[model samples]
Target: MAEGDAGSDQRQNEEIEAMAAIYGEEWCVIDDCAKIFCIRISDDIDDPKWTLCLQVMLPNEYPGTAPPIYQLNAPWLQGQERADLSNSLEEIYIQNIGESILYLWVEKIRDVLIQKSQMTEPGPDVKKKTEEEDIECEDDLILACQPENPVKALDFDVSENRTIEIEELPPIDHGIPITDRRSTFQAHLAPVVCPKQVKMVLAKLYENKKIASATHNIYAYRIYCEDKQTFLQDCEDDGETAAGGRLLHLMEILNVKNVMVVVSRWYGGILLGPDRFKHINNCARNILVEKNYTSSPEESSKTLGKNKKCSWSDGLSENPGVSICSYVLK
Candidate 1:
């Protein structure tokens, strides 16, 4: 190897090590040989409303003659926001030519996310007024307008119904989403002690407009039945053929019980072939392990904090990051 190439490689290695230390669990090395890795960044570490995965590919000549290639994976990211983020990343590369710029690029994206969150923050007064208005509208109709303006009262009822639907969603645990070629897969996990609870969880999830819009919401559940000495188990593919069965099979292999796992896939208008199944299973497995549903030590180690290997066949790619498949449209 030439001296310059060796130096570039050394710098890249140092940068990756530093990032791993700095980000800790949020950093994931996907493919070591390809110099492919990703970092999950949130506006707030404690409680983040906006989170995105930054996948970076360092070419052999990185930091010497070539800039690191990157992709921002977030279903919410689209249109001008996506373009602007891409432009900002390019600008960082241009400004820091011949230097390891991953850290800078990450901070830049975080800054943008911070700005986004701030801009989208609802005002206290507006929120309070909306809640008050909902109650007041209902009361006024019930007291005064029961005879007249029935249509207006119906409209108000519909609005309140939507709000109730959103609030009905149970506390759900979400797995870090995996993305490739714009297609994304994320797992939603919820505790369910019975078959009725499983149905409730799925119904609540669909209440969220973004999740309801996913191309596929493959799900599986296994509830332990002490009386019968058998398990109440079921699965649904939602649209993706056989995906539900595969997800349920994974749950059974892990020996997880009283849990419902839903893997939502938002197809990016591309056929991923068999690779799609890999992502779906990975998403399911990651969440099951993270939630302490599995007892295997080896399986536990493969959660978001460790290096999650991506399969490379037919030139397909997979990148994992810390995300809940909420699909929050901005």
Candidate 2:
């Protein structure tokens, strides 16, 4: 082998050894030929059911000019979900070309799996049934829960008075953070019943130095007034151009009410152009879906389809990309 080739191979071996040390012997392995190895990643730290079994093969010019080869396996995931994740891994590799990305790939896949677990319906597996069977099951369940006397249910007696009260909305603090090409996006969601609550939440975000330093802190809020019997909506771009209005419009179309969404972006020194807007909206939409602010998961999927078509319009100007970075608050 040429001198340069020998040096490259030596460096690759060192990297492999370091990875093995860091991930432990069980999680990382090197093949006999020193050209390929496997890394096993689990969704949970202890007793994980979902896992990504990744095999990486280093090319001759790896970490200098060419990227390594990767094969991924996750039996629980299939079809478009698997394909999309594979593509995302490739994109991460391409973004960090000429550098070590095995660790990043592992972490990214773990995060994706965690998100998938949260979104999946929790229950024991049931055998597939025909439409008639489903209908019969639904009928049986309804009959079991219903009261025999429907008319007496609505009769309220003055002697035995009862009142129903609305449940208070819960506080939300978890925010999901996404990064692309050094640019960072964070989405925060909270349930707001009044306009005053919206102002307080926005104030709190701005009060934090990390959030305040962001290049843009675009926000949108929708509140339904019980006394007034009307919807109140507003948005602010925070110097992100038309981002605020777009976010507000998104909430309107999704039929989301009594919620506030804030997306903060920190400049990462690269211009993403129109893709920045896409990322911002995606960040917000993901939080909405994760928090169950929208309807059922099936309906949320359909709403996303409609969102893509209407997100871009003549309202916003096409400007050169700006630097952006962000962090999520707990």
Candidate 3:
């Protein structure tokens, strides 16, 4: 190996060692090849229920001429939130090219997680303390600490905590039934407030005997928490691999919030390969268009089909066997 290449490899190994030490064994996950490193991180240190897993692969010339490739994964992270973090990571690498950037990347992600946590969590006390109030509190503390006279402390009773109940909204099932070959795709849409609601909606859909038998009940959701003022988005591939992520990405691009889209596919015994992804996205997009959730007046008027029959010939070959027929549920 050339001297320059050898030096680059040594530096990369040193950086990896430093990362392992800083993150510890439990938090850091390294692949067998030692080329890929992943760290499990959380927005809140106190609670790690929701976490972001960051993984990076160092190329042969890393920190010398090539940049490390990285990906961020989280159950409830999608849309602009995911894009922003990715962009920041790339910017960090670009600004500090040919330098040890693993540490900087980790710290930058930590800062973003903290900021996101603060936004999602409740803010601190609204009332501000005046200088006079601070002085009074200090004097009280000093008086209480004196040994000459016993401080008379007030006893307070513990109050019972009351739980506030949230009403459950019924799931909305709307879709455009599309068929390609022997496969059938029925897309369903519903408004969801929290992750729990997303689960509930999926459960309700699975309850239907017709939907339960489908080979893949792929789904994606984008919800906005009014209380936290933060966006929550997620996707599940079911048995369709990356189909769920693609659907979720489409929803994010459309700026759809507080909505979940599920595409149930009854496999026709034929493997569609990449074509399945196209069909899945089209099914979900048709529902969004019909509900007017992602369409503007001008765009809708121009794009809306006259006979309610949407065709894919514009993008596909002349003999594409797919057909999308939309239906809006009252």
Report lDDT per candidate: 0.64, 0.60, 0.60
Q: Which is superior by lDDT, 1 or 3?
A: 1
TM-score of 3: 0.41
Clashes of 3: 0
Flag clash pairs in model 3: none
Runs with alpha carbons beyond 4 Å of true place in candidate 2: 1-170, 227-229, 296-330
Q: TM-score for each prediction?
A: 0.40, 0.40, 0.41
Give candidate 2's TM-score: 0.40
Better of 1 and 2 by TM-score: 1
Off by over 4 Å in 1: 1-170, 296-330
The order of the candidates by TM-score, greatest first, is: 3, 1, 2
Candidate 3 segments whose C-alpha is farther than 4 A from its true place: 1-167, 226-229, 295-330
User: Whole-model lDDT for model 2 versus the true structure?
Assistant: 0.60
lDDT at 137, model 1: 16
Model 1 TM-score relative to the real fold: 0.40
Worst 10 residues of 1 by lDDT: 136-145
Q: Give one clash count per candidate, in the order shown.
A: 0, 7, 0
Instruction: Write out the backbone clash pairs for model 2.
Output: 266-324, 266-325, 267-323, 267-324, 267-325, 268-323, 268-324
Query: For model 1, what is the error of residue 263's alpha carbon versus the real structure, in angstroms, after optimal superposition?
Result: 0.5
